[model samples]
Target: FQISYAGATDSSVQFIFYQPIIHGWRETDFFPCSASCGGGYQLTSAECFDLRSNQVVADQYCQYYPENIKPKPKLQECNLDPCPASDGYKHIMPYDLYHPLPRWESTPWTACSSSCGGGIQSRSISCVEEDIQGHISPVEEWKCMYIPKMPVFQPCNIFDCPKWLAQEWSPCTMTCGQGFTYRVVLCIDHRGMHTGGCSPKIKPHIKEECIVSTPCYKTKEKLPKEAKLPWYKQAQEPEEGTAVSEEPSFILEGWSTCSVTCGVGRQVRLVKCQVVLSFSQSVADLPIDECEGPKPVSQRVCYSGPCSGEATEYTPEKAELLYGSLQEFDEQYDWEYEDFTECSESCGGG
Candidate 1:
């Protein structure tokens, strides 16, 4: 029979050997047991037996044992490849991938994606996306520059005046005339159209008056005409018919002439008299020693005959009586005839 010991130490092995064995044999004949019997067992032989036999016994004992062993810890290591050293990645680096590069031609390294799900592409470094939702690229733009035009004044033509008068007046004076005025055109810089008023140097006078005339259509029509008399010229009369005197009288104050005749005791007066005296009898009676004629008398004569009788002797006293008397004379009276007819006839001739 074989025996197996699972908990056998050197001391326990000694105890099992030293204890009494039953139905055993010994290698020496010093006892009643032979070597084959339990009494004669060697420690080496016991160790060999325990090694093989205890393995089977341990398997059987595993059913009754509790499994208190902890599981092994996991050993994890980084598997992904390192990012490229030249350009930063959107997910890995601090760079913002959604924004566009400032300029693509100048700076080629920068790039952008089309959209969230879209792929990325290289572009200008300076190209920047617009802040608005649908917009992209430029922040500012340029426009064409605008300019204005200047003002100019244009003077009118004044060749319509009568030819003779035009020769005497300047062209400007002839055109503008007394009542009419002139003005100039105006222009602005850079602007295509002209606008606004002319400068003070070119502006027309405010009080200018206009003259109406027919407009000339051709060169021949513009030629000057001969001067004619103005409407306001004074009228004159012929020199015949008793030489009308410009001097005026009462009956014909503005008339130019008067006719006179004398006969018998009546005579026309021809005197270098003041034109004013013709209307004033009082002025005619004033003293004039230069007129030494016979004194005028108021007399009545009958039968159309001069006084005819013997002549009386002449004396200063009688002459005064004859000249100063206002009396009737008879044809039978004696009177001397003095020829005063020459004075009367001469006074009437003109």
Candidate 2:
């Protein structure tokens, strides 16, 4: 004899033990029927069954599930803020999962400007909603509190000395060369007078004197005075036996004939004279007007020996003859002549 279980049959029991069921068992007892059971289940057998049993049970159940769990409703006794709904209303709960939460009293509530450190308290429901919705409110636009940077001072070394003196309580000295001048203001001293006599004053120092001088005259020599003489001295008397003579005369000795060529080619005849002259005074004492006189009249001659050709004067009346002679002479030979003397008589002597 046999006994039957509630969901078991002999064939079903054999089928459950032998077949590999991958899915599609919604009516089976091990199928997930509630959220606590997770999503799905496997099958196993533990108690009595007949030979026709088609049902099995899994006492040690295994479940496949997602990580995020849905929030549950808060309990009534513990005070807490209720989860917000889509209708824009905030509700408070008596108790959260294990402890009391802050009560939500208003909408559009603001969270802390800073972070919520820990634990829950009365907070803005809208801010909580926004936070839960993964949104952050922007910071307010306000002027930044300014903090000025401090001035930095650097240390000085011997090789990199400061241009000006650092201490006001010390006196400094500068060395100068000869023939040099300098002006300095001394403001500090080592005698601990840093405030009372801190005025600037001009100080000049000349290392050496610049002296220039001229030479002095000697005082040892003495001399006698001499008589003064006139600037222009008198002329000395003539030498002994150099007596003066009476005025001498000049006489014409002989008249010689010469031929002078005039104009281009024609010749003229003229007479020249030889004379002997003497003077009573030295040549330098003679009157300057003696050489100024009218010239003597003369006739031109053409030949040196006895004149055989007709002599012509160089006058305008013989111009035609002169021109014809020049033409004929120039065709035969080339000749040139010049006058040695010219005079204009203004005095009576010629």
Candidate 3:
């Protein structure tokens, strides 16, 4: 938000821009249960609310802001206790015209047996009879034999769960001392798969900052590229219209992994310069210097849950046993990168 004002001493005018404001989601109170006895479900939903306006607003106001995420609706269980029996004696009564017809029923489906490669989920199938009071109870399967029954089990995940796989790390960026090394990482599912289901919080680091213990004494320097040059020494004038964009912006990539595998850590992203042509609106990469305006934030705090209580840390040798070893390096001795041990998040996101 910005406002322009005229100067009292002159005709010149200037504008002042306001800083962005923070927004959040607000959940409504849960509604009453669907049932007074047996199992029941109650629900509550989220709404975008404005503190200053004191009113509930459209979802676009909350959703459009990156930091303001709409939370999942809350679901609660109520009236769980089973209803008491009507009579102390148990007897088989003859079927009558007033009774409701018995029907086949099934319980909720259980979790998938496997996350990928085709798995099965099952539910308990039974015949249920409803009494005059509208109470339902399990009855003998033969009671509903005339009706077609639902399958007791169903197939799930014709192999859709994708796993994160990391390529072997490259040789250290520096030959004689610690620098940087990186590798490729990807998310892959089976025969048919959809894009963008992978969790961003647990993604592994493509580049590791520290490695290679070999020591060296080296200094790198740069020479000036511009100075007054004679006509004979100077090259031909550069071609015209080489620059494509009138305005420059930043291209922010996905965030890198946390600095720590467990507990609290710092995560950062890559912000590169980009060019957007005014005429065509086509975007292209540009050198960092070309970009204008305050840079977008590329770093934030992250949590990968708490560290395992184990006394020892997981090492590369242990990872090799599980994931299989990559090619060996020629260096006589160097400390390998530690593997992500184990952590359990109590809540979602950092």
Best by TM-score: 3
The Cα local distance difference test for each model comes to 0.25, 0.26, 0.56
Candidate 2 deviant stretches above 4 angstroms = 1-253, 258-289, 297-316, 319-350
Clashes of each: 46, 21, 0
In candidate 3, list every pair of residues with a backbone clash: none
Worst lDDT 10-window in candidate 3: 322-331
TM-score of 3: 0.26
Worst 10 residues of 1 by lDDT: 140-149
What would the per-residue lDDT of candidate 1 be over residues 1-350, giving only the tens digit for each residue?
33555564553322233422112211211212112211111111001112323322323233232442212222111212334555453223221232222222223433333222234444332323332133555421110001111122222322221111101111221122222222222232223333332244543232233443533233653243442221122122111222212121111113222122211121122222111122121121112221222222213111212334524433445434442332333223323433121112212221
Per-residue alpha-carbon lDDT of candidate 2 for residues 1-350, written as tens digits (9 for 90 to 100): 33434554544322233333322212212322111211211222122212234443342221212322222222122113344566464443222232222222233324433221222223322211122223544221110101122222222221321121231221111121111111222233333222223322332221222222333233433121231121122123112233322221111223243343333232332212111122211211222122112211121223233234646534444544544554454446422333222123312322
> Which lDDT value does model 3 have at 82?
55
- The segments of candidate 3 whose C-alpha lies over 4 angstroms from its true place after superposition are 1-98, 163-183, 189-350
Better of 1 and 2 by lDDT: 2
